[model samples]
Target: MRVHLGSDHAGLDLKNHLVAWLSEHGYEPVDHGPFVYDALDDYPVFCLRAAEGVAKARAAGGDDLGVVIGGSGNGEQMAANKVEGIRCALVWSEDTAKLAREHNDAQMVSVGGRMHSLEDMTRFVELFLAEPFSGDERHVRRIGQLDHYDRTRELPPLPESAIGLGPDA
Candidate 1:
């Protein structure tokens, strides 16, 4: 797998570690980075590139993934999701990392550099890289809804039970 990585100054260390780790583990790691640390660096600048790399690779029929890192990972995740066809999940635990891929079929994951130990974050990334999407009917349906909304900007209909329960009703 080709894993694209990006990070702000806060996550530079962890991002560098993962780059080496990913290569050592036989995955092709692409560093879309701020080669040198700058305290004022922006997460979106790098995160968006990483997300775009994954989106472009996948659109070309490749199984590529991405990782974006920042102090809290919240902004990085938001930035990544702004790219078309990119599903980026903010993963804080091994379970969430695995679920990001299995349930959401996410092509990218965001990690918080200041939220956990280096070892814990590393484990989460490892789990994320190893998991596969479940491809279950329900999961696929939900993903389809999201994809539909992404392409059409049209909201899915409310459930029958809630159809007449709006504030206007």
Candidate 2:
């Protein structure tokens, strides 16, 4: 898989480490980076590119993923999520990382550089890369709702069962 990475000065070290790790593990890592550390460099500048790379790859029928890193990962996740067709999840644990792909079909994941140890963060990424989205009917329906809303900017209507009170209630 092609893994696109982007990060600011705060995450430069971890991002660099991940780049090497990703390569050694046989995944193609594309760095959309601030090659040199600059305190003032914006996370969006790089993160957006990484997210866009994933979006474009999917548009061409390729299954690519992205990793956006920052001090807290909040801004990086926000930036990546702004790109159309990109589902970027902020993952803090191995379970969340796996669920991001399994449940949400996330194409990218955001990691907090200052929040965890190198081994922990790398393990989260490893788990994320290893998981596959569940193609169950319910999961597919949920993802479809989000995709529909992404294009139309309209809320999905509540189902009849959800809209009415049940006799058991």
lDDT of each: 0.95, 0.94
Q: TM-score of every model?
A: 0.97, 0.94
lDDT of 2 by residue, 5-112 (tens): 999999999999999999999999999997999999999999999999999999999999999999999999999999999999999999999999999999999999
- Name model 2 segments beyond 4 Å from true: 161-169
Measured with C-alpha atoms, the lDDT of residue 153 in candidate 2 is 93
Give the per-residue lDDT of model 1 (tens digit) for 1-169.
9999999999999999999999999999999996898999988999999999999999999999999999999999999999999999999999999999999999999999999999999999999999999999999999999999999999887878887798735
Q: Which stretches of candidate 1 lie over 4 Å from their true place?
A: none
lDDT of 2 at 128: 95
List clashing residue pairs in candidate 2.
none
Worst 10 residues of 1 by lDDT: 160-169
Whole-model lDDT, model 1: 0.95
lDDT of 2 at 25: 100
